[model samples]
Target: MSEKRRNRRIKNRNINQSEKSTISKRSKIIWIGIIVISVLLFSSLLSLQFLEHFIIVD
Candidate 1:
């Protein structure tokens, strides 16, 4: 009975550790995706402004 309890506790600990790692990884990926999307949006806006200026000059 004690051995079984020890095994169960170990299994639970491993599962918790795995869950924490995956959560951290998922958050990191989400942050990276947000940063990339914001950068792309900013660059596109800048390009649009430049295009407008060129059109006005022509």
Candidate 2:
């Protein structure tokens, strides 16, 4: 094996690792955003129900 071939292989391996980590981080961020949105939506719904049950609107 030559030095150039060895270097190319190492470079390719590093790039693959970088791509995998980038994908993982992006997915984590997406999941966090979804969870936050869901919490906010549920809380708003609960508040609306509470108001309807306890108060009257004219």
Candidate 3:
């Protein structure tokens, strides 16, 4: 019975560790995606402003 309890505790600890790693990985992916999207949006806005200036000058 003590052996079984020990095994259970080890399994639970491993599971918790894996879960923490997965959560961190997921958050990292999400942050990367958000950064990419924001950069794209900023570039597009800059391009639009440049085009508008050109149109006004012409």
Candidate 4:
């Protein structure tokens, strides 16, 4: 691989995961937004699967 790719691989390999889960103050809002969107998406899928009534046009 090229030097850039090798450096990226090394950097990724050296990731300090101890602090990865600790969300920053600013990122907390973004995390909440992400969670809300994920929940909405999951609920929409569930509604489509089991709740929403659809008419089949044959």
Give me the candidate number with maximum TM-score: 3
Worst 10 residues of 2 by lDDT: 49-58
The true-versus-predicted C-alpha distance at residue 3 of model 1, in Å, is: 3.8
Q: Estimate each model's TM-score.
A: 0.83, 0.84, 0.88, 0.46
Once fitted onto the true fold, the runs of candidate 2 whose alpha carbons sit more than 4 angstroms away are 56-58
Error of 3 at 36 (Å): 0.6
Alpha carbon deviation, residue 37, candidate 2 (Å): 0.4
| Per-residue accuracy of model 4 over 1-58 as CA lDDT, tens digit each | 6999999987886674435645465589898999999999999998886644553331
lDDT of each: 1.00, 0.96, 1.00, 0.75
User: Model 2: per-residue lDDT, tens digit, 1-58?
Assistant: 6999999999999999999999999999999999999999999999999899788752
lDDT of 1 at 13: 100
lDDT of 4 at 54: 50
lDDT of 3 at 40: 100
Model 3 Cα lDDT, one tens digit per residue, 1-58: 9999999999999999999999999999999999999999999999999999999999
Instruction: Name model 3 segments beyond 4 Å from true.
Output: none
For 1-58, candidate 1 gives per-residue lDDT tens digits of 9999999999999999999999999999999999999999999999999999999999
